[model samples]
Target: MPRSPWWGRKVARLPERGTLIVSTDLQGNYEDYYALKQIYADEEERGNEPVLLLCGDLVHGPGEYFADPARWPDYLGTFYRDRSVDLVLDYAEWIDHAKTVALLGNHEHAHIGGPIVSKFHGDEAAVLDIRLGDDAPRVHDLFRSFPLIAVAPCGAVFTHGAPRATEPDLASFERIRYDGYARTAINDMYEEGTLGALLWARYAEPEHAQALLEAVHEGEGRHAFVAFGHDVVRSGYEKIGKEQICVSTSFGCEDRNKTYLRLDLGARYTSVDDLREGEEIRKLYPKA
Candidate 1:
């Protein structure tokens, strides 16, 4: 775990020891949120000091307002009401904020001035704030403090989106200002400008990830993968090229197939294949 400022840290360096639990794109899904917590809690109860990394998009989920999502068939929008407001309040008061590391998703950036993320209700970030009422200010402060990406010693970099950057260096990340960027609706692409690309890229080719890895650890994990969430990976996880893996823990994915990373910090993974399914990649509720 690392300390954070009132604004942003831009990047996080994960602990060199202990179990690392990585989840992504929760997006106000109450079911998966609780499942994640339970997974962490179980690890703690087992005397494992598990570090949880939530890779952004924690808010602005489509409630009944957006109608039944076509891709996410298991979404129980009517019954449980997995509203972003509740997620905010629960997250704010959750006993584990100290152990939880969050990434600044583009949706979250909308409130604090990064990009306009509109999904269910136009300007969903603003709508979340208005709905938050008194808690909005406090929650917004917490969101502002979240990092854009986390670098781990296990030969992997965790981020909300593809590992896109202005310069091919880590020091450059500290200079980001988080200004809003334009979305090219013609191609349905959200291009992150000079400030930050931490929450934009929807896809990452092997070469693209190779360039990113070359900048970190002096190419130590050049053959490794960058773990991220942004697109809706059908199996809830997919290997992209040779150096990128997308894991969709929640939001617009199958319940049984949705996955998260339970990585061993002490063990260095050489490639995405080292991340074995049901071993390193665990489903929310796997059936026997």
Candidate 2:
């Protein structure tokens, strides 16, 4: 039986209209996760078509917990609870809905057959696997089903990390393969191949990102810009070079600096310049 294209496919092409909301590494902040969800739900209620994209890494929160949530000694003093387990459940549920799509982050890849990730626990994947228990396989399946990249008609390329790739073209990404994993798993995520660049590279040069976006939109012969999350951006969102934007929604930054991206998909954008903080690049918790 052929695998469903919507599940575990290397790339996803989004529609030309509606609203697209993008979130970066959730790494365990359940509060921020729901905050973003509210925005999505509100958009739908307001009669706007909404599309939600989760850019992976919704794992590895604080290892030790104190009675007080904010007492975890976090920067900017946040109530950082690792409700990753709960978020994982919600994440899968959202993807089950036709309007949501998830892109695999390096942390997610760690569990099934990608590089091992460690933030709080020594081996986050191993520890998380134990925590997941019988549900681990199901959770892994959810991760495996995530697309590596999502392209929208508005010329935005949404991915987990930097756009640099060892491969010459996007087709190489589709050719990635894995052995002894879910038939639904996206291929070669564990290797230092194209998938590695997409899942792990930070501080990637602007030209590098632009080139990859070009290839991504090459079929449509459209100019494209890159929007991704992997590294922390203190200001919540960063305009990288002329063609890329980086957002930090739920991890690696102060509570106020955490951010997401929201845009009218019907409008076409040519560069990161078109996005403004508090507008397209939104703060999950705004500072009053």
Candidate 3:
């Protein structure tokens, strides 16, 4: 068995008794933001402090609605002028209270890809430059600073996507570290077709999930779980192998329903909840 990549990392430990809000593929939906805010409020009222783990794709890509040439300018301007500002403000508030960690999704990389930002600058200054202007550097730094992989105190691994092609054995996994910008970092897990499979793959094979579980268990010296959110699971959550779970938290044209996972680290339990506007949050856990 190989050693776990998280070995000897001081920040990898998730605090016992703390709650974790595992969310993914927000795609710049303010409704989802409001739902998260409400969830936080509810937890506070219950005297619990929780950490938010954003699995990635905080921003929606141009492909989402830009396929129409006629609506390109309108959509692009809205994202840069309106959505960008709102995203920053909302994220700021999130970071103000609970500890927040984010992973890079393909959408974030699209920002660096220059197409969206190219609409404004026409040059190569980047989208953050056009959208954020003087504040572009700070925003760029923020995105670039996101870690690719984060380990919870309970040893559960959280990522925007799952590792498939480069799925490391225990030894390789142990050597893994958080490098926001390095090629070897988890960020690159979805770069090439082979590696990017982690970020872009839609389904998880039972064998791969089981391999991950075994690696985490052997390397971390504890029973561990893995969670990812790139692929939208219409069912909300899917159990893979013995202890791996995959969830989709995005709400939009594809998935009209808003959902998120509330993980109770202390109880070693997780529940899926539905968030609907003007309605009470419905817990869809224990599978009816």
Worst 10 residues of 2 by lDDT: 178-187
List lDDT for all candidates, in order: 0.74, 0.75, 0.52
Give stretches of model 2 more than 4 Å off.
1-5, 65-71, 74-77, 166-169, 178-191, 219-222
Q: Residue 11 in candidate 3 has what lDDT?
A: 22
TM-score: model 1 vs. ground truth: 0.87
14, model 2: CA deviation in Å?
0.9
Candidate 3 residue-wise lDDT at 264: 62
Residue 106, model 3: Cα distance from true site in angstroms: 2.1
Winner on lDDT between 2 and 3 is: 2
Going through the candidates in order, what is the number of backbone clashes in each? Answer: 0, 0, 10
TM per candidate = 0.87, 0.88, 0.65
The sequence of per-residue lDDT tens digits that candidate 3 reaches over residues 1-288 is 111222133123455667777787766655555666677677767877766667777764344245465555531222221254467556754564556667766556544431232322343235435656776665555565555555554556666666453444434633433333332333344455423555566566655645555554456423565677877666555666544566666532223334566666665422112222223222222232
lDDT of 1 by residue, 77-193 (tens): 222345677776787666344477788887887777665666777677777888899888888787878877788888988878886543467787666765534343412333545
Residues 1-288, candidate 2: write the lDDT tens digits. Answer: 112244667787788889999999888778888887888899989988888888878887777744366566655235576887888977766655548878888888777677556667767889888888898998988887778888887979888987775345567667765323323233344246667778878767766776677677775423568888888877777787777788888776787677888988999888888887768878787762
Determine the C-alpha RMSD for candidate 2 after optimal superposition of all C-alphas.
4.2
